[model samples]
Target chain A: MATKRAQKMEETRAKLIRAAREAFASKGYAAASMDELTAEAGLTRGALYHNFGGKQGLMQAVVDQIDQEMVERMLVAQARAASRWEGLLEEGVAYIEMALEPEVQRIMLLDGPAVLGDPSQWPNQNACLLRTTQTIQALIDEGTVKPVDAEAAARLINGAALNAALWIAAADEPHAVLPKAVEAFRQLATGLLQTEG
Target chain B: MATKRAQKMEETRAKLIRAAREAFASKGYAAASMDELTAEAGLTRGALYHNFGGKQGLMQAVVDQIDQEMVERMLVAQARAASRWEGLLEEGVAYIEMALEPEVQRIMLLDGPAVLGDPSQWPNQNACLLRTTQTIQALIDEGTVKPVDAEAAARLINGAALNAALWIAAADEPHAVLPKAVEAFRQLATGLLQTEG
Candidate 1:
């Protein structure tokens, strides 16, 4: 039950976000031109300002959108896994691979933190971090993981995975680097698994 | 062996670097003004440009100075510990605590990466990362750590420690957050310990 004006407003906002994402992904946040973004969306500077309150607001919206998509992708990866531990591991690897994507790598991982500040302080909420903590908690409860602090474990693991992705992205031979990063991550995660009563 | 002129040139560079570090630490790289920095150093703007090409160049110099000092501090912490593994852990925790310092957190951790692009690609060299890799390799060689990939493990553990420090820096009560981060790091590192043949 939306009015015609409301529907048009929503469309304009979404259009601007998509346009801004493409700009920010390719050129980065600091270098991306507001004019180029507005033109790319087939809108004017007024439209961007009116819809987003300015460039910073637009970047926040872009971050929130990308963050939600990343969380959804992780959840799907987790569901596809055969075991809870496998699910956690699979979700992590998926996150690493997802971070390898140029758009996500630039917009979400690098530029996002630099432009918006710390991930924990982000206003949109870190759904991906939440999902990670939940999976670790489940593993601890099932005795699959050691009795470690779940949130702490999640942050450490997430940090490691993020850096691994950055390594792959920065490497001249990402293909060669991918397997090494994955194996290293596996070893780290496996160390957290419970070996005895 | 050195001329008086050469000695004066070295002093000028050091003075400018110190002035710029103070400016960048308080106001960040983008906001820091080159004119003010040179004036504060009691050096001419020409001296600033001659010694360091520009603002970006000055920040790079500051980053190198801080990075070297950080490695030195970590080495001292390691030497104080009884065992190599304990030394590595102690160095990591010391690193986390050092990162809590406003100057280190702002100049090195936050603005350093933001201005210089990825830490892996910084032109000054990541001496801290190299030290961590060397320590891990030594531990592996001594059979203190498992025979895992050394560089990979170093990158993962470094990433975890850096994130934990950032977490503390962002916390409202860093004192409360510090213990949780350290314990979580211990749990993660303990997982990496060699448990069996």
Candidate 2:
């Protein structure tokens, strides 16, 4: 049994988030306004404050939602692959795909760093990096990758992959940029791994 | 003896660029105001218009300044190094150092993507990538590195290096990040270039 007040509150929060995403995506984080966001949501300042503490809170919520969606998608891709290399390839491709997504790309890569206080402390970045490092560690343990510093390698690869994504996101023709980036990544990955002779 | 109008125009254009850099660095591209920019430059709207077409033109000027600085620094480092590996390492380190500089990092990596109409048409990115490819091609021709797709390899390495710069730029304690990223880049570069004995 859901209370009417609680249901209404949840609905208001959801609407605020949707509106915030649209505003942030279109206007970017720095240019977006609280008034505009509230107007888009068709909510009042009272409703906004009652839901999110402030603009920063609204931005954080948006980042968290996008991060969760990204992590879920990566996990699914990782699960579907036949081998570690294949899994990593699929994960890389999936990441590039996520970067091409308009709303997700805007929220996580573009606006996230600008709005979030410190990128090192950014919840989404840290989580994604950790996940990437763990996956690379698993590959190393499985004898698929060379015995190197998994954390460092993960950081390098993740950094490169993210840059590729950002490039595609900023490009005029994202489709063309993505395939070229993915191919370069695949070649780099092949060169990196230690395959049995 | 320069004409009065020409000299005044040069000064006004330089002032506008400086002001625009500060504004874009601080408030970001979308958030920065044209009115505020003119005020900061100590110039009138007419002066701004006469110098640069508008805010977008001013931003382009700022980007051009940053691009020139980056290319010049890399060229100097490459000239000083004794070997191709040394040149590449110095160039990588120089890039990381440049990324630490206050306005350079923001204007180039952060706001450049945000404000610039389309990244593919960004002259700086294209020029830098081509220059790096030429460097890589030279190394390959000298038998200093394995022969591969020079342009693609350059893009991958450049993309990785740029993202490393972006990561450092986005960090709270940039000093702490630079060493780790540089070490990672060093290893990646060594792994990339070491020939089979």
Candidate 3:
């Protein structure tokens, strides 16, 4: 009975977060009202206050949740690949795919920066950059990539990947962007890492 | 005598655009006011009206001017390079460098998207994309780059470049980002294009 109640509570919390994400993404942080958010979540204002403290707290939670989800997705994509170059390529493609998902697009690219004010200071950016740098270092150590500075390479790749996501999100035809970007990324990766043709 | 007068007027117009660019870049579009802009330019409201029709018109002119400057700079960088690969690398570096510049950072990355509504419909985006596509196609046709879909590659590169610029603009240490990004770009580009080690 306790377990079932816990699960239900968790689901409710998730529902609230999802509703808040949509509200913030569409209206921006400054413009979105707490009343509207609670109504959308189908929860009472008191419940929201008890759960999240306030709007800033809710926004932080949304960012944290999205960042965790992105990391997990990236790890899965990297692990599934056969070669280091292939892994990197798949990772890039996976990022674009994730960005194209409506919820992810709305929360991560559009609303996250818009609400956060200064994107460089966002916790998600630092976490993402650290993860990316570590990945690049691993690729270099494995001899899958060139002996260039891994930190620098990671920053560039992360920047590129993030940009690709944002562009895909902003475009009218988001679906069409990934294949082309993936192809270029594959070629770019192979050229940078492989010893010879 | 008339030609001299016309030249003087053009110089004044350029001064107004430069001042507006600085204002828009630093203050953002919504926060920046015409009174402040004129003050920054050392001109009165009467002069401002004579030069640009109003704030919206001035913003549009600023966008147009920046767009033209970026295109010209890119072309110049491409022209100065000794090889196609080098040119591409230089172009990437130049782009990051330009992004670090205070005015370019402010106008292009921040104010452009913030005030411009949807970028897809922006005439500047269309022209820029078209030019980029043509450039990539030419390089591919010349056997400078590997045989691939030029349009797709162009979009990917352009997207990456734009993102790098945006990141740098937002970063606390804007100067440090491009060197790393450009190095990574060099590796990526080399991997994509070069036929031999």
Candidate 4:
């Protein structure tokens, strides 16, 4: 349905993003060289600029790609859980666990927030937030979760998971830190659950 | 007894910190000019460099001062509470409330983390974390809180509070968003409580 020129432009954009992601994940945003990434993609600096504005723009695109992948993985984790509540908890834990991966830790967790303003304000994060908020509302309706504001609960829950991942990512011994973070995350999420008094 | 030279140096350091704080609070870290700050402080660039290394160093010093003050204020709020549990909740709410202040929001919540890396790794936060861990341990020992890793719980709780402050700081209508954040925080903290059978 598209012209050859338009299709080529799309290919160029994907190539640039793929190249940038590898460079960023390997050497970090600040340290990665733009010239090298463009060369790796078989493109020019002008192409990079025209396609992404600059390094920051490219970083955002790379982060968005990784973040979108993270959401999909989390959704799959949620779907695999035995119940909705379990799914929510599983998703949060999966997010924390994903920090163990070098790519996720380097790009998405550490460099992403520092390069971009706030994770909450990211366009990709909005979809994740919307889904989480809807789940919280449904849980509240089912009397599984408390009657607290659904969006508020979702933000706090997501904030907790996000910080935990950041913690794991920055730790010297991430493997050693993983269990404690996962456990604390589980305990924190329980606060939203409705207790049979 | 201190020498007159040392006394003068101390005064100079204090002057630079004060000047830098006002500039950073108003113009943010990136836009705030070091030249203007030093000029306003009645000091030279050499003096700022000698006292705090440079602009980033000065920002760190300013953040440390503000963060220490925040901790003291939160402690005061906790001490005013009727019970330890109430104090804990009050302290978190007080933290979120402080984000409304322009000075605190700009310096500590926004620019601080972006420039200085994670807040959990900050030296000033170490003191807060220590106190929080101790409180969580005490509450668990007294059967007022669930049996969870004290440091882990403290990190998650502090993380939630920190992110909530960041959220408030960046929100368009922070005042309207304040109540939801505080209430959700209260609910989250309740997750750590030891419910009666």
Reference contacts preserved by each model = 0.56, 0.22, 0.41, 0.49
Give one digit per residue, the lDDT tens place, for model 4 in A1-197: 89999999889999999999899888877678999999999988899999889998988888888778877888999999999999999888887788678787677666766567667788676566667888889899999998998877887887788777777777888888888988888888888889777
Position A135, candidate 3: lDDT? 77
Each candidate's interface RMSD (Å, one decimal) is: 1.5, 3.3, 3.2, 2.0
For candidate 1, the clash count comes to: 0
- Chain B TM-score against the true chain B, candidate 2: 0.89
- Each model's TM-score? 0.93, 0.82, 0.76, 0.89
- Residue pairs with colliding backbones in model 4 are none
lDDT of 4 by residue, B7-116 (tens): 99999999999998899888877678888889998978999988878877888888888888887888998999999999888888887788778898677766776667
Model 1 C-alpha RMSD to native: 2.0
TM-score of chain A of each: 0.96, 0.89, 0.78, 0.90
Q: Estimate the lDDT of model 2.
A: 0.74
lDDT of 1 by residue, A71-116 (tens): 9999999999999999988888998999889899888777777667
Q: Between 3 and 4, whose TM-score is larger?
A: 4
Residue B10 C-alpha lDDT in model 2: 90
Regions of candidate 1 where Cα sits further than 4 Å from its true position: B1-5, B42-46
Clashing pairs in 3: A191-B191, A192-B191
Which one is best on TM-score? 1
lDDT of 1 by residue, B1-197 (tens): 89999999999999999998899888877678888889998977899878788877888999999988998999999999999999889988988999898788777766776667778788755888888889999988988787778877888888888888888889899998899888888778876677667
Return the DockQ of model 3: 0.33
Write one digit per residue (lDDT tens) for candidate 3, span B5-53.
7897787777788888888877766567878788777776676788777
lDDT at position A168, candidate 3 = 65
What 10-residue stretch in candidate 4 chain A is worst by lDDT? A109-118
